[model samples]
Target chain A: MALSDVYDFYRRMEDENVILSFKGEFTSELLTSILHIMETKMVTMGISPKMKKRVFNVLVECFQNLYHHIEATGDSPKQIALQKSALIMVIHENEKIIVRTGNYIPSNGIEKLKERLSFVNGLTEEKLRELYQNRLLKNKLSSKGTAGLGLIDIARKSKNKLGFEFIEINENTSFFCLDVVIE
Target chain B: MEILLLEGSAKTPEINFNQDTGVLELRGRSIPENSIEFFKPLNDWVDIYGSSPKETTQIEVRLEYFNTSSSKCILDLFKRLEQLDGNSTEVKVNWYFEKDDEDMEEAGVDYEAIVDLPFKIIEVEEI
Candidate 1:
């Protein structure tokens, strides 16, 4: 809204070590803007080529998940607006790049999210590998409807455990926060 | 059969496959929103192409990034090609990696270990 407000918000983001943050309508236009900004930042930082590509891949997957998979309802207009103002922060901490995405989740989805995470977390690296391979062999190439493997892939790529929390908002909704750190 | 040439997005790869030329090329990042949907047509196209049996098929893959799921689809594609090659059809995979990207180089080697196809690992400079 105000010039000073925008400036202060950006300053606060920077002060908080947020390298990147997006808070706008998540339309195709907005998605392109985010991708362009990320590419420019990676180029400017002179990040390793592989890391640059990896970051781009992660961005694409995360945005797609948010756009198509997240459950929405009649009251989702407010949630969508909040998502437009949602925080996607990339912070540098402990010699790792931490990408934090925050958004609201329907109360009912919390259990499924937790269940998926627990199932993945319980696996040994070898077991995870085996599971991935088994899925590959058994699944057809046409069945791609949120197999709950995106987070698992994230964990595998980062080689770190996932950090998440559920902030209760109301009886029917909660704010879900996921923090993934890539070393 | 016609060739399909689609540019890669942040989530997919640039594909260049021609039924006539038999020079299939896939380059760029691959972490598609729906791995199966994105790769299904490619796999189906490859299956059809394999039936025709090209005299020589060169598949050049220059992927900078791909998720674990994509890795599986890639393996499946390669295995299909390897099977078609059994009929004396010459097939070669030119797997390219950035000079400093050991992960990609090793991935090429891994695929080679599993498939009985002629695969070559080519190191290229960062673009």
Candidate 2:
């Protein structure tokens, strides 16, 4: 990257009020450090405990979702590259906090993910709670160590609809982006 | 039965389950990457405790922050508590949340709705 391009990127992030951003491997230790930084930032900004908890809960899921879903497969060059392919950003938009995550996913799984996101987005607050409870009670954790409640929990905590996109990167992998807004 | 004691870390919560006294206390943050793995022992303890529980069992939950996986494991733990014979064992849950933490309070309320046992939502200055 050239100095001029780097300057433009820095200016763009500043203009967008990007409080925190990361691109690379999503490890549990890294998530803990990110949460630590955000907790300090919220406290320094004098955010109320209620607001801070909401942001904290949603942020935890955002990174954990990335950590669990970003499958590295084997030690191929492509798989190694996938380790650094993920991105997460915490931005301040108006009075709300917007958390965005982007990562490469197998193209075959896009339909299932799209369905899940759309189903979560189509519900009202009351319905979302109902769905969350139902899933909590009925589902068992998969072999991948997920109860599949991350999306529902994000929507419930934020009390807003989930926004997402599936962009085709190739025949085998596609870029998936999730947008969560905390008011 | 022996006391089940586990220290809390950044990802796991502190667990102190006394089988003889039937006073189970879980405190601190529970954001484990794999909640089921961490909570299995507690759940198993509850299963064993249910066979011969105290006349009045008291369970205190003081979690500051928990992830979605831990949320489910918490429910599973409570569900196991519900299985004790109500006639012989009186199980009560005291859920504590700090001031200004409405999400935690609401989470307590949600758990209250699901479990069959009597649950108390307690407000505290800090956890």
Query: Top model by DockQ, which number?
Result: 2
TM-score of each: 0.80, 0.93
TM-score of chain A of 2: 0.93
Could you give candidate 2's per-residue lDDT for residues B37-123 as a string of tens digits?
Answer: 898899888888877888989999999989988888899888888888485799999999999787789889989998998989999
Q: For each candidate, how many residue pairs have backbone atoms clashing (under 3 Å)?
A: 1, 0
User: CA lDDT of each candidate?
Assistant: 0.73, 0.87
Judge the docking of candidate 1 as incorrect, acceptable, medium or high.
Answer: acceptable
- The residue-by-residue lDDT of candidate 1 on A1-183, one tens digit each, is 888898998888778778887755455456567777877877887776666655655565566556655555645687557644445667765556777777777888899999887787787766765565556555554354444456656666556677889999899878888887776
Candidate with maximal TM-score? 2
Chain A TM-scores of all predicted models: 0.81, 0.93
- In terms of docking quality, how is candidate 2 classified? medium
